[model samples]
Target: MEIVASVTNASKQYKTGDTVITALQPTTCEFKKNELTLIIGPSGSGKTTLLSLLGCVIFPTRGEVTICNQRIDGLKQKELANVRLKNIGFVFQSFNLLAPLNALENVMQPLLLLGISSKEAKQRAEEALRKVNMENRMLNLPKMLSGGQQQRVAIARALVTNPSLMLCDEPTAALDIKSVAVVMEELKVLSTTGKSVAVVTHDLRLKQFADRIIYVNNGVASENPTEEELFH
Candidate 1:
């Protein structure tokens, strides 16, 4: 019912030498609250470009991006980073956790960067790990955990900030089949907690868990596509 993010006629272009490559065509869409949305496409289909634009990793060449009622496309680097820190959470294909740090410390890192006190960050990190069912492994280093556990820690790190939007890029790509299933289940549970979740993945196995699917093709996006349409 709530609109967590919206892109109004957004498009992205990159200029290399004399060539201008358009990554995404003008598009408008809304990512709703408490829903798990998937942006699916093959390599070079603009899925990553679109995700980058939506996640505030990159701005559009034209149009607007509004997240939690704030326009992000035009924000200065620091301002954009602040908006992303406060409103958006990102998870990547790789777990991206430091090998030396334990799960709790990894989750606490962002909170500390946000100026949250050490004690408070620890408390918040513990709570976040619990949410992802990783409380039992909070003290374990990344090397000691399985791939799924590491991914869950990565997710907890994202959630610890209490951001309204969570963006993931091919989060399950590096996992085994069973780990992928577990991670997908955890992501589904996270979506139910009022956060807007959008993942850009080319993995068809995870498509069954999505509430809505956005198909990107040749730099254009089509929403609510059928599985048959996307797989072929």
Candidate 2:
């Protein structure tokens, strides 16, 4: 398993009137390719902050992050954005789909922005939606779909580009058990097909999907050897 993403002594801090809050302490970690890893911790423990750093959404206040062998800290903002758009896929807790666009159009947006021809973009989008078994719902708007269906559409949008890394933040937060299982099953299939998936979640119920588990506490991380606990 080659290292796909690495964080070396990373930290994020913020300053208020008279005090400085350290949102992340100096932390080091690495994620390998073709594995599903879980970032589990209580609220405010920096799980999301770490994901942002790894995803290149924000630079660290200190230390370095490397993605696909490129040092993100050295890149300019524009360069970083390009790298993020091309190499990373993000699944937000809110199911960030455009309400007005149908499922196929929403999935096609990324390819279109990358300058792919409209015809090619639609072709790829249809293939992605089909991967998640949502081809039948291709023309449904976000509001017309159930929560689980909407989330599957969002997943297809993220996977359409076949990104090197997939970052999912609380992906199953509000879903019922059945819907949660549906999403987790799809993610499991994704990881098996060779894309690296990292999930930031508090829902232990989904832990079984993780090939590796890293528990974050007070901005630090430690390996969870009891990953089998997920199945038990």
Candidate 3:
């Protein structure tokens, strides 16, 4: 398998006046193509911080973050943004769709930001929606779609970019059982198609879909956690 993204001895810290808080400890991990890796932990467990590091949303205070084999920890903000645009896709718990835009338009937003022409963006967005079984609802607004349908559209938006790595945060948190199954199945299938899928989630039901699991707690991360470490 090929590594699409990785963090080596990466750690994060925040300064609040005279106080310094550590969000993540120095840790190393890799996310590979054609695999689904789950980052699981309880609330305030540093999983989200780990995800943010992989997503290039923040610079690691120490160590390195590589996406598509490019070292991004030292890049300027504009350069980091460009890297994210070209190599990464993000899915949030809140769907993050535009209330006023229809599904197709929402999916097209990323391509449009990349300066792709409307015609090309539309064609690609349609294909992405089709992949997630949302082609029929392309014209519906977020307000008009069910929670599951909206999530599918969000997936399409992420897929439209054809990114090497997909980072999802609490993707199934807001979903019901059926919707969770549908979303997780979609992500699992995507991984098999040669994209690295990393999800930060609390939902244990998603474990069945994972090819690998990363457990995090108290700012520490382990690639292979023990049963006691995972539950205690």
Q: Which model, 1 or 2, shows the larger lDDT?
A: 1
Roughly what TM-score does model 1 have, to 2 decimal places?
A: 0.97
lDDT (10s digit) by residue, model 1, range 46-159: 988988888899999999999999999668999999999999888999989988999999999999999999999999999999998999999999999998899999999999
lDDT, candidate 3, 1-232, per-residue tens: 7999999999999899999999999989999999999999999989899999999999999999999999997799999999999989999999999999999999999999999999999999999999999988999999999898899999999989999999999998988899999999999999999999999998777888999999988899988778787777
Tens digits of lDDT, candidate 2, 58-127: 8999999999999999899999999998988899888999999999999999999899999999999999
Candidates ranked by TM-score? 3, 1, 2
Candidate 2 regions with alpha-carbon error over 4 angstroms: 225-232
Q: Which 10-residue span in candidate 3 carries the lowest summed lDDT?
A: 223-232
Clashing pairs in 3: none
- Most TM-score-accurate candidate: 3
Candidate with the greatest lDDT versus the true structure: 3
What TM-score would each prediction reach against the true structure?
Answer: 0.97, 0.95, 0.98
Per-residue lDDT of 124 in model 2: 99
Candidate 3 segments exceeding 4 Å error = none
- What is the TM-score of candidate 2? 0.95
Q: In candidate 1, how many Å is residue 23 off?
A: 1.1
lDDT of 1 at 10: 96
